[model samples]
Target: MEWVYIENISEYEGKEVEIKGWLYNKRSGGKLFFLLVRDGTGIIQAVVVKGEVDEKTFNLCEELTQESSLIVRGKINADRRAPGGFEIQVKEIELVHLAKDYPITPKPHGITFLLDLRHLWLRSRKQQAILRIRHEVIRALRDYYDERGFVLIDAPIFTPSACEGTTTLFETQYFGTSAYLTQSGQLYEEAGAMAFGKVYCFGPTFRAEKSKTRRHLTEFWMLEPEVAYYDLDDNMDLAEDCISYVVQRVLDRKKEELKIIERDTSKLEKVVKPFPKISYTEAVNILKKNGIEFEWGNDFGGKDETIISNQFEKPVFVHRFPAAIKAFYMKRDPLDEKLALGCDLLAPEGYGEIIGGGQREDSLEILEKRIKEHNLPREAFEWYFDLRKYGSVPHSGFGIGLERVVAWICGLSHLREAIPFPRTIYRLSP
Candidate 1:
């Protein structure tokens, strides 16, 4: 007898095997029965005959319940009717610890019920497939940058300074000092870009959004890269390439996982580059043509993003938004003082704002002016401003929320399902 782990049944057919696994589900048909078991590689059916085994063996396997941890000695064989196209012939059975009645059943449960038992709910096929896809997406992202010779830089999670605003930051005591969680790694990556030429940061970022929308998460992962001697065009090219590559890689390697999760692949296959580009003025014109009425100085809302994304065959880049509606760090367009050199990439199917990027102002005087005008503390960011004092090349970068992109690529409705342990505005437990 050999101790074998079952993945594909053909590999171990007609052989006596020692198996240790948890019982997932059981079905009884009087004197004969079928027990489904999983050893993490995959699930298989265990056919038990009542008279073929002794009374003790029959009782040990017969009274099994869902999620019961057990060790069964069996002969591996092929059965076309098995769910995974395999079956196990049980000769001996033993108990580890009977997993008591599970609070979660196989039947369809409410979202609230599932979230409440997220610890156990993660074992389900849907969630397991999604989180695995997320892992692949992250792996693809790292390999893409590493192959391009981009240095991976880690940004500070706790900073004395903040990006854009103070109201949305999570403030806490840091060794007797007030430090806030980072909202985006763009600013930090910009500083690294000045030193390393090209750099990227992938890490958890926090935002205290008060809304209860399907898109908002208080804690999420962000992939941001900044490159010196590059302008807005450079960033747009990198964002498109990086995004398309991840989607393509997932489709190629994880087709089985995708099928199990029931993701629509046709939409994902159409995510190739050469995404349509439109200027802020042009975007506003299109919105007006689509019967959207909005002021020019105001920033785009969800409605505006949907209208722009719907017009294009794939993702669209809406660029050069009004300076008043964007962050002050963006470089102002010389041709139009009111316009800033920024771009927002909208995902297809109305998945809003996949990427937000812009050319950064390299002038020491201009950057300082914007920082002060925004009422941000200059003393805390003296190190950041020093890059401008030195030979600061024209730099650019963008941030893509990992969860949002994954949700769109996987064709999932709620962004919460994209992560294993999603931290939202209200929920923060396993």
Candidate 2:
């Protein structure tokens, strides 16, 4: 007999093949037993009839429980009503391990309970689908950058200083010296961009923020793309094109997984190119028009981003925020020195910001002045300032949160489902 996976069972129709997997569920009707088996790739029903198989085989089927590991030899049969339009007629059964009293059953489980058993809960159908979609999203993200001539530059996990700000740094003692987990790879990627012209860093980033919101994760993956000669407008174009490509790729390939998660495919299909762009001033005006109070120099919260993004059909870019609220590295707009040439891409349907980028300051004197004004340690950024002192050109880059993008594409309520093993403010194990 030929060995086969459940997903490819159709090609072996009317032929005996050995399927090594675990029993998902079973139903019995007198002499016939229907065993549903999943092999990670897919699921199919295996029919065990007493008249065809030996009495020992029939007795073994009766003792089978949910998630019992087994190797089944069966002949594939076409069944339009069966899942994947295929079923199997069992010829032999070999028990590998009889799972006794599995904690997760056919019944519904609460979110907390499920999260506690996250290690095993990943075997569930819905979780599997979510992870599969996440895989596709990452693949599409890398493909987009690779096709666009971006060099992959892996950044370090440990850093001497903070990338964004010191408030969210994960501080720890590093072999007698104080160090921090990198919050963003943007600063390192800037150096890489200067070397390779156009480069990107895709890796895990850490933040010690004590936020318990659905969007907050203690550790998450970020994709930071930096270019040596791109300005704020060029940065916006890159972000828009990348996001649209990722969404379209997920829609094209992960249709079944999206259906399993009950995602609204129509909404994702509308995520095409040419996302709407609005200035921070216009966004504030729109908020005020809706009777929502917001300070001009304050950063937009999740609620504010949702309100602003809901007005557009796809992701919207809110640009040119006040420099006081943005990072010190952001370039000041020539037309208005108080406004930074930065943009935040807010996803539609209340997913909030997924991408943040801006043109970087190229002048060493101005950067040094901003560092002092922000009360940051100037010595820590000496090497960074040296880039400007030697030779520097106008450049821009953006960072995209992987989980946030996955959540938006899968229509997940929380970002935790987007990652296989999420590290949140409270929950860390499993």
TM-score of each: 0.94, 0.98
Clashing pairs in 1: none
Per-residue lDDT of model 1, residues 114-182, tens digit only: 998988888776787788889999999999999998999989898776776644888899998899999
Q: Model 1 residue 158 lDDT?
A: 87
On residues 271-368, what C-alpha lDDT tens digit does candidate 2 reach at each position? 99899999999999989887899878888888898899989989999999999989999999999998999999999999999999999999999999
Stretches off by above 4 angstroms in model 2 are none
Lowest lDDT 10-residue stretch of candidate 2? 161-170
How does model 2 score by TM-score?
Answer: 0.98
